[model samples]
Target: MNGDVHVDLKTDSRYAGRLQYSCSNKICTLRITDLRESDSAEYKFRFITNQPGGRFTGSPGVTLSVRGLQVQVRRSSVSYWATLMCYSSCHLPDHSSYVWYKNGQKIQRETFSSYSGNFYYPDSYSCAVKGLEGFPSPSVCGHGHSCNRVTYTDRSICAVKGSSVNISCIYNSYDTDIRSKFWFSPERSLQWQNPSQPEDLSEDSQYAGRVQVLETERGRSTLRITDLRESDSAEYHFKFTAGSFEWRSSLPGTTLTVTDPDLQVQVIRSTDYTYNQAELLCHSSCRLPDHSSYIWFKNGQKIQTETSSSYSDYFDSADSYSCALKGLEGFPSPSVCVYGQTCNRVTYTDRSICAFKGSSVDISCTYNSYYTDIRSKFWFSPERSLQWQNPSQPEDLSEDSQYAGRVQVLETERGRSTLRITDLRESDSAEYHFKFTAGSFEWRSSLPGTTLTVTDPDLQVQVIRSTVYKNYTEAELLCHSSCRLPDRPSYVWFKNGQKMESVETSSYKDQFYPRDIISCALKGHEDFPSPSVCEFNRLFQRRYNTN
Candidate 1:
């Protein structure tokens, strides 16, 4: 149907016997009994209908195309159970029967006289036929530069005691749920044994009480495994049967690795001080905690005994210790350690300085220890030098409108604290400052600010082609942006100059590798398509959010 074609049939005969005629409705029917000698240019059907006046002659042709075993996967490194859809289309009024096969071996599953379908199973999938003729080699969504090639995020890592892990095999097959899908191991038989059990088959074979399909909401699914055990590591396979079509499994193996959440504290530094008289003070730190606490340690251990501090020895007459040992000051320099380990690692790592209007860079900071609890971590770009503007507040120093969306911290968890920034324009770069507070102890920063270069976030746009015969898929434009987020930046996905959103005020964000990489993928499916990521100023304004 993509192009135009002209076809015709002709034959001459004078004296002939009564010719046979066969056709259901107004269509012509051609019958061939021989298989080996049936190699011809076309299959022609002649129709001669007797009318009241005379007889009319009409004929038609059906092209015969023979297909072979051909299956493809978008990514060569995808996990097992990933979807592998097999399909083929042709011009036909009605099909009598349909069948499928693998390596020439007949496949026994669901059959479809209709052409296209999918397989959620893992393995090789292909098709054969009975009444229909001509087939083509199948192709899959393989890996390459195109985004449509199905790049995966390696979310296959599952936790031992966690809930079912979702493995979304997303790709528009434009078919129904019944289509066969391949779910299997590429190297070995993919299987999952209970994480809480032994590796012997004496319990249960293939997946013996271990693997389960993750639930689907809004039509997305993932393969899940619970009670993660060491032996529950293996590839799984899924093969599909759709009419005469079969496709092989191209998904990578799904393995189950056991991981447990654990953390411990180890004191790396401790010192007793007695700068002057009756007060005894000490300082100590450990592997530290991110965004959690600021508890002080005393007498070789956590301050498991005291609560408040009152005084400190002369202490160099420079830096003052909070709530020191008042009465103990005279009893020799008593131990008074103030711990500062609760800085959010994900939000306060790589502390850096931002750039000015004409030239600037992003600030960074991270906290990965297991000490004190983190309070609030923030950044100051060149303090009073660089130009500033916040979308919410005014750009004034003390309470100036300095930063808005650009100032951010990673969503706090039990283990990390860090920050990232993006969309760095010239005025948006410079010495970015870092300030973190854990419990009662506060840590401002290290020396000057972290410098950022706003030359341009590595950005580019491109197009993608599809191997599947033109279906109901849309032409999508891909936008790629690469930048190291020093501060947590609100990635504003923009389509043209306007933003892509359900609400003008609500902001959307997802987390990736903290501190190192952050990406914003907004589908560009409209005309005049141009996608971009914008990180607004935070100090100058208030972050806009629905929450």
Candidate 2:
């Protein structure tokens, strides 16, 4: 049967004239010819005897794997030699010898499936079985090189901070005498340079003593970076100089994303309160290596029996759970309360916020307690805490002199609280955390909380596009902001300090002259407007003007 659908041996065109079956003295045989890769499947034989209820089907099925030979390339660790192997889906006979070809010419006869040699660029290699010389593997260039191109081994990689990563690539050039080669990140280059020069990663002070370049193979290079930081996240490109010519493709190169090593326990399956059991999986932004063990924590204590990444256990409503990597126990995940109530926990509604200057924002969160009576609660910013105060004591935001009359904490709901801040200043940009005390226990403030960023509200009119027509000049203007505004607020456009009616969007397009001045403001805050800019700026007009 083909996946649940029966295949007729006599009428099915796919198997017609190719399949044969015969039975003699209770011995059965089946045969097929010209097997295709699609024919690979688990096949079972069924038969029926003359007696009633004698129909019998095989308990297990035979698995068939039809595959063609592929040329796989592997490089030596200490030398420039590489091994080209004739690989297939199924294992070949141990006694069989293989034939190798270099540039379509017969090269050697090997007893094994692989051939080792000092392979170099511009040389192509293939392999085939000794008897089946006509079915040769597809030719693969040495070191994965093709003429004058650089191919990255991986397009993107995500790694945790403080971990090491290796970015590799294989490059080939028409001129084999390479003079210089190195890796660089365009994102980290200086913007002031007219033609941005690629700075070698090894020379960058930021990567000093932490970067190394390896060129053990003929055309392969690897950039190893250790003690990674989140700021190191960027696109990495390889560059090489062959004679006077330099090669650096304009296309995007391998992107390396360095994330924090924080772990989180994700709920795979949650049961009702009656069952009080759930399946939880430890997760991280960057994937951990295979077979990495995990450590589970319940109510601030480690659970010794659980070592796998996932755990299933009965939990009480007051119990909170967390996880961490076995070796990196210093950075454990924030504890998550089960059932979302009756636990000493605080969950912020939003993790980050961006607000305009002189505006107001509401940072809210839901808090819970295992005890009925509450002792005290307040909001604070650890970053702005006074050093003179007691290190263990958290000062309330309401009592802070900087936010004397601008901050208010409102607890309108039984379990919800919102902190509203008015007249936002740039100094207000800091992480805001909520804390509450129930009896003798206080919610953990080490867990990540909402971060607020107060940015300048002034908008700038940027020239997105410009067209120089025979009769007039048409340009598209965009009201740009340094920080994203909340709620997708509508924008008000102004021409020479006069509000432009009928156009309330963030963008405007029309025939513009050199004297036209354009600006923008938020819909409700029209009193504060962006600085007017000339329509035909020298930089923009120079880009489109045809002298």
Candidate 3:
């Protein structure tokens, strides 16, 4: 060995990762590993020749400095909507990509080059919690541009991998400056998803790539997944960034269920019919109502084109099962048996609640047995007062203006049926009854109707300015209550022997100061037309207007 040579490592394993080296020594080769700075010095070379004084020499050699990349948040002090820039002080070359981790979560990455300057190339980005726009102070964003930013994005829920869902987006910023918005799969894999804007879009695999954001507003996005698989159940997150701002977002996903139409036949929506011309109705309700199909079959024969809204929408009509609804999938099964209240084997479910014009409530029903083979189910409210379903006393599903389409059946089948009602007014309050039929047996229960007592919230009423007109201009009567019940209570104002219609709503907040519950006010009640003193009550309790 006569020459002295030097090998300078651009980076050691630590500054980067790990290092490996091998040397061929004479009759055999030598291998060494796990090398670190501790072994940063001398090496000797030897040659095994037949000569005893064979060649042997020592050389003072190269220094290998491992420059590994370590990232850190500049400042620990942080607030909502703040931006924290990342500072990387490393003299490294354009090798592999750089990955950024936030709160231990790996964000997008960045690509560095020999010619790229740290100042021109941003490794620091801004972050806002959720979708709120505003700078969160003292924040840290990893720099390594693996993916671009997502801006002005919206999210919605739907069956997984079913169909790509459209999420609306908006961007008032520059278009060319922003490159793209990246879609992360349930597994957090980065993939360019379909941008569903300015046209029709489809769901993708894992989202089927069916998701798309507007090209102009790439940050605004919509997700579409097709052939929804159960494994597709998970949360999907998206991160969008443009020249100056970056947005990080995520959505909690939902599950997918491919359901079959629970078909069957029966008539029981209206009044008690021992045997009369009562209307027979059928009903079908499911989470994804569109997936369920309806067919009218009699004695193993499918009936086509003869079902009415009444015949197929209800189960126990005191009437005839003469009509059927066809091509209507997602609806409960069809019914052929004429409805009646015959055998005392009576069975049913009833639940109810009360609320003011601005509150919410839920109702439910159930049968005696909770079987599985039983396919179809139905629900009806006596308030519906269906006419044809029950001639003598029909609880019409179509005739009741108050009930409308507000009722839905919660399918916990083989057992109870539930319904959710929202934004209830006083008029929405009532003793809602349930009539469900599974298998060949029909059940009706109404003894203890589900009672919902939605007491009115305090009402607030007052003319914008004043109610003192020159000759008493029709004073506006405002009726307001924070009552949790939807059924609104009718108000009767009496001044003398005269009657006045007390109209208007919402008076005041429920809890005021310390103990003041609420207040309601109504106008137009005069002492002459009927009675100036108006009586407002729910469940028969007069609520004196105090606002």
Candidate 4:
């Protein structure tokens, strides 16, 4: 039973279909399927015989916990090597050995919680418990990359027409002497004389005055487009030449989709009819900037108090509603009749997501059909190449060999579906679209979908001089990551491969000798420690000598 509610294993909607109970002469067992985090709880078993006062209850009960595995990357900024630790949400047996995989191929000899090695870009990595190899952590990309590599900040972006958008990327080259670097688009060059040549946006007459490529940092560049138009939508790539080689322009870059400047009011009715209220949203095809403000109108009259994108109140069938940008009030959206319009669309919870490699992610969408019974639904990725299948058919993600044993589509409630992907890999980066079929109707596949970008997590050890002394130096060490850890995990420090006791914080301060080496890791993942760094480096020694 869950908190005073008798868990009806046979008839209740929540448990009846998924829970199975079996009994032997002296032993009984309960089985549950399609488990969720919410199912983590205490359970008690009770049995009653025909005789009076013969009922028996198992005291204390049994606690069940469910958890997922995650891969944590640890590295120092100065080193090329990274340490990968397979961690679980809940603690496992201390003796548990881990299995490691690189680019889906298992590493033969790795059997520890952590593995340290030189990780490079393009290749993905993951880990699992030795006995549970089927349930590995999501695949992650390496923090380091080969010299000639370019990484885009975003894989795809959707922008409203007439608005500005910036597509950025960072490039690296081994050659210190650079030749030239510029942004180009293959789509624009298709119509040019040399169809095979890359066309720089700066030289294109279409974007002459509106495009600017700004080098914000040494290796980072931003292509800012002002007063965007539908014609400006294309795949933008960055190319650079150094020494004898040029970065390939054929590699996939950022995809930009420019949409029309139109809006619609999405009506979400309240489940309870007695309330007679509905939630209204000023919906746009493409996601707007976070700082954008909206204006709401009811029956052609501006609602002064409703400036946000969403509004909720009791609705009247006679009323009509519309919305517009705060500054562009003249171009308001077409009015939508309340309770009279047919609704058929899919709204994603997030337009885009940047997730850590070797992690699980859920892409969810709420779908509505006008007036027919929904029949079938599935999720597919348009980014997947159709070289091996029918070109006209969109293959489901579940049927794709690349995502076998890693993808699941869940429909826990009506009108909502969630796509859960485990052991995420950099190759899994794509646009995922959901399709549903109703009586005589099917959701359009041309509609925009959610974009997923999988990136590798990085950890580094930062050293700061706290105090100076004649013979030695006192310094503070910090364990840093590219992103915040989920639970503010406790840290473990190591000095020359030996674990330091009683130190659990990310920061550690102490006096050190010239021969000392330092490294760190998350607590309970001691096997995968950060690359060790000499506590006393040449720079520190020089400073001491000068003093």
Candidate 5:
């Protein structure tokens, strides 16, 4: 029927609300909705006219077939359990009977929006709607660890102001129906006689659009807060309810500490060492934990634990010296140089770095000590929460499961140390501090070590076209990545498998073609280019074919 006189099914009760018809500029349209399993049939149109023998039936009819339900797995974090939701991609009648399976065998039949279970790593599971049990969803494996009770991945987190952090926990429940899950910061635990009755943080305007709960799966949840502020600092806890049984984590919940930037002194020392003279240096860790003044001390006495972080004076082999924050004198950093032992002030080259994922990065720092015979030097992560505060590193990071064989303690000599990590993963991102010890002095640089960020470059391409002109086939291609690098690298553009000439910027303008493809990547990372996207000059097709 050449875009005219489309059949109208509004008057038929069987097709009411399921059919929609309209005619715009002689282009007739018919739409269907709320399809059911029994709606399969051959559809045709018939046209009628006022003159004799003017009625005609459509020559060919279209048959409609519907697909079954699909399943989606949701989890709070990658390291938790999952909840499977069986749903149809399109509108369909609801059904209560749903079957779940683990590795091809049926496990449960229920009438709930979500099916819950413990996530066993490497074990595959799936679900299907009752009538279509034979066509179950593709099997998926559970990621991360399995927990028998509610547990947090980390008990405390320190974030930089304006950065984001995720507070994640795993929970288990015996109740069949989970009513709610949320995160909140309560000043006192005594107030929570009924933990489930507390208000959700998302409802509070202070965190209106800035906070979100990631309930990706049953028994797992994560509270993500973005654009952090000092006001957002609090002890956060997670709560959940399944039917009548409600539970809140009693363990020390996740504590968030946000710090702003401040000015701190940098320790600079001379490499020259003499038998009769010893030098000691002290400086700010990164720029600001922002200690206003630094006090230097010698062997537990306040005599000359002076105001400056750096102090250089003649040394007797038996004399020892340490430093402390000016006002807070109780806990002084471990003494640096003592009794001709390794005593040095350590400093990092760069406090923070955002590196590409799957790439290698070097976290470098320099140190100055009185003892030329350095006893030990290594790197550690303060956020890792392990008891590594010792004269020697607690364990070789190269042997740690996360960094196994991927981490290298670079050679340290003449006041320098480095940690080189390869095959960078998102999990590798952290603030790595350096530590060293000689004879009687042990030092851990907690201030401004290297903060490494591993990011996967996700390129997003935006296609723009002229709105007013027809057959004017100029398309604007704009490329962007998920992260903003410190130095903001230039973009690399590719067209039809070849580098584009003079298209080094993120935005490029080009004339449209039927099969012309364009893609982009980071200037130095062109090997992994983004998926090529083709631009179609729809203006040309409309002007030539629609007439």
Candidate 6:
């Protein structure tokens, strides 16, 4: 079409490398490697015979469509089971047998049509034809959907403010004609039954741009809310409508409790480092459930991994300590310093490092050890550890799936070690510490491991005005990150493109008036501040007047 021959099956430079053709018994077969979507076309094969005028072309050329397989999930008639079908627009051979996989592992051999089994999660399934087993279809999860009902994976969850939480459930509809799916908290007095109300909570200004509804195969819907606040603590429900029939489920719905992190340090003065002497316990103001586990920190460094509510370690009165729930390390308690510990022996160059996503961070620490020959030197972070490991058990954090390719242990000198992480993800935000083994003695540095905060920063604002009490009206603007960051992060606030002085704290309190445009961002990351949240005096007037 562009003054060039397009169909050069034999000599085309691009196709020459992969295209192959064989002619035998008057049948010509053409094969190409790594087919592209643009390869869809019809090609007629002309045959030439030894006899005069024996050349002829096939009347109807074969049409080839190159496309990937997509797996469609259906609820089986049998309860708790799902049927996965792999589909391709190009008609497959009649004799094709299907191969099935569960969580990327082959589960079934040559079988007919589809695969059926008791599906469980966190396992997902996909299917492929016998010959193209290498390129399996996209995975579809066994979403725990019951017959025409909605089921939650967990009935209750706890989240930290400024962190994200996901509320998920599996739903089913026998009608097959799904019109809509949504998540909402009836506590807000917003119900789908109200025709005027938006079907999804994301449409509400309060939750817009902050809530995400993710759907997987077999009707699994997960509502992920970022920058959670105290007001977010509530029971959440899911609803879906099929044709004319609709169902909203609140029975045993997911209840989320959001809390702020508070760390209290208790130190006993003693000379020796032991559980009984000069011991430190990281405490929380509010006790979690008995079954919940605890993580301990010395200064800012993690020191204990006991699952109990409190962590006790041989920390001197001079050392600083903190604590947090095991799974909720993102919301670590504030560090409290004792009279003093020898934190001077080994300390991080920077107490905390905040960098943008995809950026690299270097966490360096200087140390003083009596022993000279360091046998084993390594670096690890709370993000990589599920439980605390004593010096006796040294795990290769480099081998961890999360840090495998992203971490590097660097030692520039005898007394200094640097932990370099690349391509930072939100999960990489954690306190990294250095460990060394010197001839029969093992040491894990404490007090302060370099805390890294990897953020694709976003700002969020919450208006907290108590109409019932009529006490006060104030808007609290906060710089929010997807992950929990240092509670004391300095913030910069702006009003109508003008910087506001003394607005350094994360949450800015202001008596906002109508038509006031305010925004906030992290100290250094002021470029992408929060979208302006304007307050309307009319709404505030109505709210206060009612109460």
The clash count for each model shown is 150, 0, 142, 5, 12, 6
lDDT of 1 by residue, 1-547 (tens): 1143122221111101112335677655543321221233455543322333233333555666533334444332344323333343434335434455433344556355332333333223444344332331332332221111111223134332232343345322322343544344432311113221223222245445755554354333355545454444544333433444443333332334443211112221213323222242222111111222223322222343443322222333212122112221211121222334322222323433422222223234443323356665555555444455543222322243444455455545544434455444565555555555566645442233345545433434332221111222122323444444224333334443555564221133322111112123323213322233221211011122211
Tell me the tens digit of each residue's lDDT in model 6 across 237-356: 788777676665323367787776444545534443244344455544332334556777653557555656444445454445566776667656555555443332455677677877
Q: How would you encode candidate 3's per-residue C-alpha lDDT over 51-143 as one tens digit per residue?
A: 434444446533345322233333323332222333323353334433333322334443221112222123333322222212111222333
Off by over 4 Å in 5: 1-343, 385-393, 460-519, 522-547
lDDT of prediction 2:
0.74
Candidate 6, lDDT over the whole model: 0.64
Report the C-alpha lDDT of model 5 over 362-462, residue by residue, as the tens digit.
Answer: 88887765555568767778656574555345445655778887888766565677789998899888888777667777665434457788886778766
Indicate the worst ten consecutive residues by lDDT in candidate 2: 188-197
Ranking by lDDT: 2, 4, 6, 5, 3, 1
**Highest TM-score, which number?**
2
Candidate 4: give the clashing pairs: 138-358, 138-423, 138-424, 139-358, 139-423
Query: What's the residue-level lDDT of 146 in candidate 1?
Result: 18
lDDT of 2 by residue, 1-547 (tens): 5596444343344542346678899887888764666778888776644344555688688988888689898888746698877888777767778887765556755647888888777566777778877456666777655645566776567777777889999777767788989999887643212223577888888899999999999889999999888889999999988877677655446788887654777653332445766677776656454576888877556788989977898877777788888776756777787666566767688867888888899999988778888888888888776642886777888888889999999999998999999999999999988877777776655545788999877577787766645545688889877666767789899887788898888889988775678889989878767888885644334444533
User: What residue runs in model 6 are displaced by over 4 Å at the alpha carbon?
Assistant: 1-146, 190-198, 250-252, 262-314, 317-320, 323-547
Q: Which number leads on lDDT?
A: 2
Ranked by TM-score, the better of candidates 1 and 4 is 4
On the 0 to 100 scale, the lDDT of residue 339 in model 1 is: 36
> Which parts of model 1 are misplaced by more than 4 Å?
1-248, 254-431, 436-442, 446-459, 462-474, 483-547
State every prediction's TM-score relative to the real structure: 0.23, 0.52, 0.27, 0.37, 0.33, 0.31
What is the C-alpha lDDT profile of model 4 across 114-194, one tens digit per residue? 898887664556788887664566566666443455667765677877789999997777566679888888776533334
User: Would you list the C-alpha lDDT of every candidate in the order shown?
Assistant: 0.34, 0.74, 0.36, 0.72, 0.62, 0.64
State the weakest 10-residue window (summed lDDT) of model 5. 261-270
Each prediction's RMSD to truth: 32.0, 15.8, 28.9, 25.9, 31.5, 27.0
Of the two candidates 1 and 5, the one with more favorable lDDT, higher being better, is 5
